[model samples]
Target: MKFLLVFTLVSFIISFLSDRNKTFAGTKKGLKMFLGLLPTILNVLILVSVFLYLVPKETLIKILGHNSGWLGITIAAILGSISLIPMFITYPLAAILLKSGVSYRVLSVFITTLLMVGIITLPLETKYFGIRASILRNILSFIGALIIGLVIGIFL
Candidate 1:
């Protein structure tokens, strides 16, 4: 993380030096985008926190543990589809789940669907991409996530 921060800072400095006006403009645009998404981000964080608090570890284990089999995969897929957590948070959470004995198959499906399929963001996606395209993309992504999970389960 420190390396990434230093690298990003150095890269930004170089870019700023190369073109101050463009750098400032880009930074401003990025900040604006961040601000625009801040509300949704905050909502997701709160929802995830509440969910974690309400759903005990034992319940999670029962649902997604190694012995859960295909039912767990289906549950994971549904949860991932509906969830709105960011990728950074997803990875750490995945690691925690793995440590807690969640099956690799379920985790793979959850992470894949969480990243690829966005039921919670369907409205926003439809607004930008049209309903047909959004729905088709999500369906394909869901199928792909399942296939990927199956393959991962086989290997791991």
Candidate 2:
């Protein structure tokens, strides 16, 4: 976390020093991006709280707490691929998943799928990258995620 803080500080200072001509615009863009993410962040927090309340911790931990094996990995990947979650909020969801005892291998595959292929973004991706190319990319990503999950399981 310290690295993140230092990185942010350095970026701010660098942007401030070099972009003196359009500092206001830069700050405005930064603020707008932050503001744009607020709604998603709030929603994630609410969801996390609700999930923790509704689901028993021990049951969750037992199901996901590292012993569920291949079933958990498959489920995580499928759900992750179908879910239309933004990158910014995935980490917190990840934390919750981890706490619930989900294996790191499953988490890895799930996260990989979440970023590389989104069901909600399929149309956009197809439009931007062509249908065949998008399909190929998603297929390859799915396979790669599965392989990586197994690798993580083996090593971990």
Candidate 3:
């Protein structure tokens, strides 16, 4: 994280020094991008908070924790595939689940599927990539995530 911050800072500094006008335009574009994503970010934050608050810790543990086994991984993967969560919020929420007794395997599957398999974004994906391609890509990604999760579970 520190490396990223430093790299970004240095890049921004170089960009500003080399071309002030371009730098300013880039900053404006970046701000617009942030604004565009703000609502989704806020929604994810609220959704995560509400979910954690409404669902009892014991219930969460019983469903997704170490004792929950492959069923828990399947549940998490399905939820991840269906949900439209920003990566920033999803990771922290995953970490919270980890702390709450969710197994590494479950978290691994959830996080991987959350990133790769976009069931919720199928409409947009299909519009861009064609329905067949989009569906195949999602299916492949889901399979890949499961394999990756299994490897991570074995190694870590």
**What TM-score does candidate 3 reach?**
0.73
Q: Which of the two candidates, 1 or 2, achieves a greater TM-score against the reference?
A: 2
**Can you give the lDDT of residue 131 in candidate 3?**
98
Instruction: Please report the candidate that would top TM-score against the real structure.
Output: 2
Q: Which regions in candidate 2 have their CA more than 4 angstroms from the true location?
A: 127-132, 153-156
Could you give candidate 1's per-residue lDDT for residues 19-127 as a string of tens digits?
9999999999989987887777677668766876788878877888877888999999999989887774677668767876688999999988998998988999999
List per-prediction Cα lDDT, in the order shown. 0.86, 0.81, 0.86
**lDDT-best of 2 and 3:** 3
Model 3 C-alpha lDDT versus the unseen true structure: 0.86
The estimated TM-scores of all candidates read: 0.63, 0.83, 0.73
- Error in Å for residue 48 of model 1: 9.9
Error of 2 at 99 (Å): 3.9
